[model samples]
Target: MSATERGESKIRIRPMEPMDIDRVLAIDSKITGVRRAATYTDLIIGDLGKIPDLSFVAEVDGEVQGFLLARRDYFGEPFSEEGMIHILGVEPDYWRQGIATRMVDALAETCQEKKLNAVRIMIDERDDQLQSLFERSGFRRGKLVDYTKKFKK
Candidate 1:
């Protein structure tokens, strides 16, 4: 079977709650090699917890193995009120088990119900693996530049 194909593992995709923040942080930290507790706490679990449809967590046998955080709002011209995926993380041990894709599928279902025709995500250009994952989940590159500037205290 292919990596994208489901195996004996049955992943349950459900709306993410604030309670799932700890597991989400652990999975993210393991994958990225950096703990981002503040970002997840301040932005995701704090804010998106109230609006749960666009955010989701994947579970296998009642344990969280992955998460996908997204929001549907004005993402500018040609795709107003569309969805924007902020983060997708899966435990290293669960990689290539179709967990991440299932979470994305869950979000897609919610977007369809909410009448959101588009879902967008911006990944770091250096992250080829992430780009491939999104592509397999039906994402394509967009014509936009990510200009950035750092501010110091």
Candidate 2:
């Protein structure tokens, strides 16, 4: 059996709530290579809590399976509402069940409602499945580079 065959259903995607932070962070840590601080909850909640209009979660049997987080921003131009998807993840156990696709659809709906011109996602080069999902959801590749710098203690 392949990895895709192993990751079958048993998951669902829905709007995110303040209470889903912990489980979401666990999933985030597994998907991304970041050591999240204990205060990660407070930080994600603080940024997304008030703006419920821009975030979502994926759950299964009352547990958070994944999450998609977006923020309102523009490309350094006028006040245009461009949404950026900062993170998207589906637990390894539930990889190919369309959970992440659903989350992206939800975000796209929200962006449409807000009259945003475009929604952007920076996918990890290694995440082929996720890149395919984004492509199916009407996101095309952009001619830009995504850069990041981490601070050390």
Candidate 3:
């Protein structure tokens, strides 16, 4: 069912702006049950690509209902540059409204315009639901492996 079918207003996907930061924090905190305000603040500051607004938001009647934060990555000279999707959050009230899918599509459109052939998001091995969503959205297991190293501060 579409948003209108569910009685929600039409969702407009557009480039995110600095002004949307507060609402973005609210939606993300709602989804993850944690407040990472500082993280998002840093992520969006001067992070937009040359394309103006590489990240985007989903709005309904001028109110932000969801957001997707992304950036371009350079892997030195050996790997091709690609777009990296760092975060996606929709207000809990707007779940199942296809808002996330639309946000991803918006990013894909931006990627296409930039002539980028790849976009990537990291999902935990156990998060089957999120993995399924991206898979349905045309992502497959790529060659790159997700790894990390930890250090004491």
Candidate 4:
């Protein structure tokens, strides 16, 4: 059945609530195979508390099928702001159903409403599927390079 025929005429997207933490962690853990409950708790409770509209979930038939967690970031000497999509995940069964795409569109709309310069995300170079998703959603490569360092005990 088509998405419309399957009663998904509209994918309900809404801000992530504190109650959504468990389901969010489940979905994230299912994808990454690691349950970082503390990390998600901070995002759902702390980050969402700060910028409620930036994080969202996709619901179908009243079940939470996917989620996108984003935040507002400021950088550069002049301090320009942008929306950053930190994490996105969908139920394994719902892959290729356009849930992620819709969530991204919702985020973009929110960014525009907030007058942010742009929306950005960092995808692993090897993850072609995710790269394609962002590309199809109108995201392009930027000049910024990501660097990380780990502290030794």
Per-model TM against the reference: 0.79, 0.71, 0.82, 0.82
Candidate 3: tens digits of C-alpha lDDT, residues 1-153: 865566768789999877887787777667777666455434454455222247888997779998888888755367767888877888887787788999998898788889876788888879998998899889887766867898999
Model 2 C-alpha lDDT versus the unseen true structure = 0.74
Ranking by lDDT: 4, 3, 1, 2
User: Between which residue pairs do clashes occur in model 2?
Assistant: none
Q: For each candidate, how many residue pairs have backbone atoms clashing (under 3 Å)?
A: 0, 0, 0, 0
**Candidate 1 per-residue lDDT over residues 1-153, each given as its tens digit:** 643344666679998877887788778777766665565534665644463348889988789988888887786566478787888888877887778888887887788789887788888899998888889878889987888898998
Best by lDDT: 4
Computed on alpha carbons, the lDDT of every model, listed in order, comes to 0.78, 0.74, 0.78, 0.82
Candidate 1's TM-score reads 0.79
Error of 2 at 41 (Å): 8.1
Candidate 1 stretches greater than 4 Å from native: 1-6, 34-42, 47-53, 77-79
TM-score-superior candidate, 2 or 4: 4
User: What is the Å distance of residue 137 in model 4 from its true position?
Assistant: 0.6
